[model samples]
Target: MTDQPQGAPVRLTAFVHGQVQGVGFRWWTRARALELGLRGSATNLPGGRVQVVAEGPRAACEALLALLRGPGTPGSVTLVVEQFGAARGEAGFVER
Candidate 1:
C-alpha cells in the first residue's frame, strides 16, 4: 500500500520560493485550496517567499504541493518547494 497518512485530516505547509510574491501566488493558492476542499492560507513573507498552509486529505494536500511548485499566474515561476511536518484540524484557509 501507499505510505499515506491515515486517520483524521493531514495538515501540510509548503514554502514556495522564486517569483512567488506579488505574482498572485496567494490568491491562486487560496482559490485552489478552497476548490480542493482544503483549509489553509497563503501569504508573502518578508524575504520574497510565499508560504502556504493546507490541511486536508493526503492526496489533495500532496496535489497542492505540486501546484505550488508548478507554473503560477501570468508572471510566476516556482523555484523550490520545502514541505514541513503534519499539522491537523485547521479552521479554514485565510490570507494573512
Candidate 2:
C-alpha cells in the first residue's frame, strides 16, 4: 500500500518533536504512509526531532501531517513542524 490512484501529487517535509525518538515514530510514520499509499522517508534528526518527507496526493499528505501532529504512539508528540510543496520524485518510504 505504497501508492494509489490519486490526484496531483505533492510533498511534505516535517519535523516532529517531543518524545519522537526511541518510540517507534519512524516506523509509525512508515506504516501510516503506507496505509495512505504515500512514498517518503522518516528519519531521526538532532534535537530529538523526527524528520519525515512524504510525497503523495495533496490531501493524503495533509492527512499525514495531521496525524504526525498528534499520532498515538509510545511517546507523546507535542509539535510537528512541516513544509509542503510539489513532489520531488521520491519513491518508497524509509526509516533512517
Best by the TM-score measure: 2
Score each candidate by Cα lDDT: 0.75, 0.85
Model 2 lDDT per residue over 1-96, tens place = 225345768788988879979988889899999999999899888889888999988888988988887546648888777887778899899999
Candidate of highest lDDT = 2
Q: What tens-digit string does per-residue lDDT give for candidate 1 at 1-96?
A: 234467556778777767777766788889889989999788778988877899888778888877776655534664656554566578788987
- lDDT at 69, model 1: 68
lDDT of 2: 0.85
lDDT for position 15 in model 2: 86
Which residue pairs clash within candidate 1?
Answer: 40-93
Off by over 4 Å in 2: 1-6
Error of 2 at 11 (Å): 0.6
